[model samples]
Target chain A: SAVISQKPSRDICQRGTSLTIQCQVDSQVTMMFWYRQQPGQSLTLIATANQGSEATYESGFVIDKFPISRPNLTFSTLTVSNMSPEDSSIYLCSVEDRGEKLPHEQYFGPGTRLTVT
Target chain B: DQQVKQNSPSLSVQEGRISILNCDYTNSMFDYFLWYKKYPAEGPTFLISISSIKDKNEDGRFTVFLNKSAKHLSLHIVPSQPGDSAVYFCSVSGSARQLTFGSGTQLTVLP
Candidate 1:
């Protein structure tokens, strides 16, 4: 398991503003992902960030709104652009610990709790 | 639509008793299933996992039973301890190996 660190563990931002969350892994990994857990909801995949490529967004998610960047294998960033109150939720970053056959059973970060006002 | 579902929002069991948490998935293509434990303000931790080929898998005091035909699975914890009180999430892995998690069931171990 990798120790994943997320910056700004939490934050409160004004509506229409953006918040960029940072995720750093202790060691190099093959893949990293971003997930969102809205209030009283299940975790939803936002995108898969791979080094040297544009993040692949899931259905109902857009790169323009949730831009992701993985400059290297051990670090990635998710920026919630033009945020709204509805975007308030826990944003988590995870890495696939290839050691498991379930390739993407991710080891998650502490997560960034975002509250939009 | 929720691909994975842990319909039971919460369950309570007495300590030292067996606690059973159930989960169901709509996707039959998921070949691997896993259980993750989550504590408040913390990320989920992997607990146990089972492959579709097997009906059950056990680790220490925790056991996972899968019913492939019914798209259902369960986690059985025998002699449950207070430390077992937490939200349990069921996840299924697709070919991509990306895990799809259930809503989660909060387990409370009563003394």
Candidate 2:
């Protein structure tokens, strides 16, 4: 299992502003994923941050809106730009712990709660 | 379309009883399934998982049953405790690294 942490555990930001959330893992991982959980909704994948490569984002999400950076294997950042009320949600970071024989298991960080005003 | 679905929005069960949570997936290609538990103001915690090759997997008080033919899975917690009250999510993954999650089911264990 991997231990993950995120910065700015909870924040209240004004609309039109951008907020960057940092994710750190105790152990180096190959895949780091960002997710969003809106009120009363399931977790939605935002992007996959791979070390030394550009992040791969899912459909309905764009780079300009949610830019991701992975400088190293153990750290990554996600910036929610031009925030709106709809962007108010819990943003989570996860790391995949790959196994030699079995499939990888994802460990998550305590999410960063963003409430846009 | 939602690939994963948890029909029950919430369930109430008495402490020490069995708490069962069901999930369904539309994608037949999903080969891996997992369950996660979440509390308020926190991220989802990994609870248990089962591979499509197996029909059941057990871990202490929790057990996950997978039915590939039906495209359904369920989580069962025996001797449920009040601490078990939390929202549970069901996730499925095909050949990809990313998982598709279902809308969670809130489990309330009444003491």
Q: What C-alpha RMSD separates each model from the true structure?
A: 1.1, 0.9
Candidate 2 — which residues are off by over 4 angstroms?
none
Each model's lDDT: 0.91, 0.94
Residue range B19-102, candidate 2, lDDT tens digits: 999999998888889999999977888889998899999999999999988999999999899999999999997788588999
DockQ of predictions, in order shown: 0.64, 0.79
Candidate with the greatest DockQ versus the true structure? 2
Per-residue accuracy of model 2 over A19-44 as CA lDDT, tens digit each: 99999999989899999999999999
lDDT score, residue B91, model 1? Answer: 90
Q: Which ten-residue region of model 1 chain A has the weakest summed lDDT?
A: A97-106
Candidate 2 CAPRI level: medium
Query: Highest lDDT, which number?
Result: 2
Model 1, range A5-114, lDDT digits (tens) per residue?
A: 99989999999999999999999997898999887777888999889888888999998999888888889999999988999999999988877464346799988999
lDDT of 1 at B7: 92
Docking class of 1: medium
Off by over 4 Å in 1: A100-104
